[model samples]
Target: MSEFVRLDPHVIDEIVAICDTTLDELRSARRITDFLAIGHNFGDFESSKQLAAGYARKGAGTPESARERVEQFIEALTQLRDAFASGGEAFLDAQFDWTRQLQNIDIDA
Candidate 1:
């Protein structure tokens, strides 16, 4: 699961940009600036499950990996929170196509 536990900082920035949200709303969502804040600390299955469902209801997506699914779940939830803070799903679903493409990037370092 640790293979992809953290929300890439660039993704967070893209989330805000693609979503085109105001700073206040993003901050109001929880002032999230780190990976440990929302999803990583959720601590249990049911809690995370509910979190995933909320994300899916919003324009955010569900990733394909199960073991690392929690990371995707949390990232989407954070997006949902920020989006909901500013407006009612103001961004189009197309905004997240970049997310779907992330798996193809060359991350071998």
Candidate 2:
């Protein structure tokens, strides 16, 4: 036997709305990461230069930095939102098709 699954459109809409709000907040947070990049100091002591470089590495200079991580999160969330929206549309289309098929059945034939 085949299993049937049902999803409430209202729930999907709510989830999509939540994702939108979260994405916006994350984008704003991502902008803050730009301020984490510390510039090099040529007129300072060697220790100061080292410290600045260290801070940069831990902040936004490296590929594995916080800024990059935030960008990855944003991408993942966007994909999730797209998936849910598309899935909801597909579900409605399938429901319509099923209803049409059921209405066309000719039991007397």
Overall lDDT per candidate, in order of appearance: 0.43, 0.66
Off by over 4 Å in 2: 1-6, 40-43, 88-109
Distance (Å) between predicted and true CA of 90, model 2? Answer: 7.7
What would the TM-scores of all predictions be?
Answer: 0.24, 0.63
RMSD of each: 16.5, 15.8
Best model number under lDDT: 2
Which tens-of-lDDT digit does each residue in 1-109 have in candidate 1? 1122234556656765654444344444432323222354454799796775554433223233221343443455555546433443433442354355444433331
On TM-score, the candidate that comes out on top is: 2
